[model samples]
Target: MGSIDRYIFRTTLASFALVLVSLTGVIWITQALRGIDLMTSQGQTILTFLGVTSLVIPALVLVISPIALMIAISHTLNKLATDSEIIVMNAAGFSPFRLFRPFIYATCVVAVLVAFIAAYLAPDGMRRIKQWDAEITADVLTNILQPGRFAQLDQNLTIRIRERQPGGLLVGIFIDDRRDPKERVSIVADHGTVVKNEGGSFLILEDGNLERFEIDKRDPALVAFARYGFDMSKFSNQGHDVALGIRERYLWELISPPDDDPVYLQLPGQFRAELHDRFMSPIYPFAFAALTFAFLGAPRTTRQSRNFSIGSSILAVFGLRMAGFACSVMAVKSPFAPIVQYLMLLLAIGVSLWIIIGGIVIEPPASLIESINNANARLLRLFGRPATA
Candidate 1:
């Protein structure tokens, strides 16, 4: 609420927002450009691509925000410190802890908001993105056949479309079926449409002829018909399996799968890793700012650059996060092997705590310690009597 606090808060927030926007723009551009092949192959529009990209922005922001805020506030503090603005505050009766209050408050706000998005919004967005991708793939595959071309649907069937009819109809259809070894059927229709039945797809011929052949002998029998219907049960989805990746599963499904699956096993590790990181992200702002402050705000006469400390802190946080990811990926592939998540957490926390606490001080400010103790402690006495053995 004070003048200096408001000044630092505004400056840091503006810088954080600038970095956040730039990062998002660059990442989205890269994603969209690299996905040109996928869009063309899958027959997805620009709007669909953008919609899918938009769903990931929340997750991206959740990833970069803690580090950005840490650097922004740390650099702001270091600039003030290196330029003797902090000395002015101290002369005006401000303590070191007093200067940290604004940073702490800002970190708390970022933490809670980022946690909400990372935990709830990010997963839901991921599901929507994957669903859209699946739809796009199916649409592309279904449109593989065009008119006036001999299109091979699969090994068992080939279709030739002579003309397109109104209202989702196909005219002049020819189908070759070669499933049975003893009998083969070839059908040609003059004016017909491909239709779908409750059981399978069928080609209804108004004026067509069916020729049946025997594989044992070179004999062909032709039947002329006014109206004939041919069954397309050959193309029925019978021995085909639709396999989707773990990224396609919902949270509950990911956690509790119906079967013992390789994909499910791999996903829990990723899910747990992400869940832990989200829970721990809010803590990054404090630890990173503290570490950078201790190193960059040390009694130095001049700053190397306007934002050196901020840049350094951001780099450090990113490095640590990547390290965590590397370990989590290994854990996902291995079975109960190399439990590295805890190690990654401890490494990050340990480095930050070491950098901050090595030279400065062990104790928090009186107000902070008092508040924490009061908020956390439980009464250990009965009838207001403190008894100890």
Candidate 2:
């Protein structure tokens, strides 16, 4: 690569990084806000909240990278044109196709990034988030046993603690179980902690007394004990099997999901759609770059209307992406939909490359341009502002 190639490559990559980070951060903040209950309602640390929420970033990047690449390419091209660098290069025998090589290099870098995230990192992050949520929910003592409040674990059962201390210690523990119609049981303990092992989760209470009231008997039977193990496995998520969603499955798993897998058996179409979407994720950057350069890469003087070209480029890219999105959605029900997406992408790239290679300068017709200028002048006159000569 020459010095010019290096210069353009570095500039575009730097701009891509800045735009990607900025867009991802802003979007992540909006998404992370929805999970604020992890800190407020659930007894969790700030670090845990941030760590769990940050896992969604890989997915966000996968979606944002192509858009950022398009923006970077547009910015680089506009800058060159604004400074007359593109015009100078064209005069010096540098064709538009030759000038596009550096942009392709930068696009390749972003495409690789998108592919990695879509293939592994994004799904891995989603899997980790699911696991994190499972772990948090399985810790019933921390989630359900809020200090100084009675938590109705079930319609017929309630538990409360006067204070929750460090190291999973519970002070002034109380339990009311009325699940049995034949009996009403209440247990009060000075202190206790939740214990989980192969057997199941248990609320092991020390220095507690239990009083059991029989439906037939007037008086209650009281039993005082030094320690007791209260079965809480039902309330805890231990030993329960959970099915991972489509997003939580890795790429390989999606490709060859188990025949007996319940989610696969139920929503095979969705899995198919997801697989194609992931496969197409990396191609977007190249397609976007092609479309942008086709519309805006031609050497033109400042006197020519570039704003209309820029708008057309933006609209074209947006329409292409929207079509892709529609294809992905339709692929869920129709197997042929993925093929249409591929055709659309190929058609866009083919036409764009043809224009770039042919040195085609795309612009609105002179009459259309004149009409828009006259309309602008009329608006200016109506607003009592002088129109430009």
TM-score of each: 0.59, 0.84
Q: What is the C-alpha lDDT of each candidate?
A: 0.63, 0.91
Let me know the TM-score candidate 2 reaches against the reference structure: 0.84
Tens-digit lDDT track of model 1 for 240-269: 354555544444554456666776555667
Q: Please, what are the lDDT tens digits per residue for candidate 2 over residues 1-389?
A: 99999999999999999999999999999999999877766646788889999999999999999999999999999999999999999999999999999999999999999988988999999988988888676567768788899999889999999986544578899999999999999999999977889988899999999999999999999999999999988877876655689998888898999989989989989999999999899889999999999999999997776898889889999999999999999999999999999999989999999999999999998899899989998888889756699
RMSD, every candidate, angstroms: 16.6, 4.5
In candidate 2, clashing pairs total 0
